[model samples]
Target: MGHRVLAVLLLVAGFVVLAPGTACACSCSDLKPADQMRLSAAVFTGTVVAARQVEGDPAGPTPPIVYTFRPDQVYKGEPVTEVRVASNAESPACGYRFSTGGRYLVFASAEKTGMLQPDPGVPLHTGLCMGNRQVALGTGPVRAGDPVLNGDPISAELVDALGAPKPPSAAPSAPATAPPTAAPASPAASTGGSAPTWIIVAGAVAGAAVVVAAWRLPARRRVRRD
Candidate 1:
């Protein structure tokens, strides 16, 4: 009886040591608004353009949604005109769920990568457990129950720190052209550098009359002297 009890105890101890162990769950002590903003790699306010399932996405609790945003203000990091971020459709995967046409204050990291993601300048991936949160879209005070911001209104310093974002360039205007000039007048329309035939005829008649009068006067004088 004593030998059997010893064998049973030895078997239990060996099994406990050899079996696979469970990994610890992810945990974080929630951070204050300022600390979270400081720790994040990129922070901005933007409007969501669209949401769709990206190509070649990885397996998760739900099909991950890729959100495209047009940035309105940049608090830190690159001032991208457009940014793409991926998060699980369900919040469990730490994905930042985005609604189309909704604006948000996003605190996200671009360190996460995907299998087919293009260059980092194009878009970035954000997930749950990354400490990313949403603040009120406007410049007003942060509302109550905001994940990290709590109820603090936006700081004047933050407003001052916002980078000057270059707006989209307008299309070039078409060149203005002078209306086609009036066609030049023809030679006939001008005097054409020639006198009329009537003037030439009048000059010839006057010269013939003058010559006849001189010949007649000389003959009459000679006859009277003789």
Candidate 2:
């Protein structure tokens, strides 16, 4: 009986140690090309259908730029379950292509195009000019062929194409300062206009009188619990 109990406890301990290895913690850049193929449902190999520049919203920190990808020379490489756009080390304008790893939303785009335009729209497609259909990353719906304007388009895709870059432990900005606070209102302010000394004394006396009256009541007696 002792051995059986010990064995059960050992088994439980082993499972706890090994469980985390099986969990999905994949980041986009962490996955290799082979993994990308295995995981994605569809893939696209096309030039930037549309790219644009945008200002980072000061109200928002570091805004993201978006890109519109249209299928041009569509070769169905392993169904892309995920996508990433990598940025260039030399420049922030053009991004490389990247793929996703195990964790969702992590993307990398590794290849960079040096200022290339999308193939001119064929007669079958007619509407907004090729460059006009960009959307802000956090602003709108994401669907195939939707125009996207990345605030820092190249950087946006580059990070997506590559894995997320190492994060700096702290921002370069000066540390935040505590805002000035007003002094707490005095008792006079809290009581509305000026209150006379007699009124304050009377209030204190009345409160003490009530407390004394309640304490003296016969029901205040406690019954001993044996």
Question: Which numbered prediction scores highest in TM-score against the true structure?
Answer: 1
| Model 1: residues with Cα > 4 Å off, grouped in runs | 1-28, 32-41, 55-60, 113-123, 128-226
Residue-level lDDT of model 2, residues 91-113, one tens digit each, is: 12222222211111222222221
Q: Which lDDT tens digits does candidate 1 get at residues 143-163?
A: 334433343555554444333
TM-score of each: 0.46, 0.22
| lDDT: worst 10-residue window of model 2 | 123-132
Worst 10 residues of 1 by lDDT: 14-23
Number of clashing residue pairs, candidate 2: 46
The C-alpha stretches of model 2 lying farther than 4 A from their native spots are: 1-29, 53-56, 75-226
Residue 193 C-alpha lDDT in model 2: 69
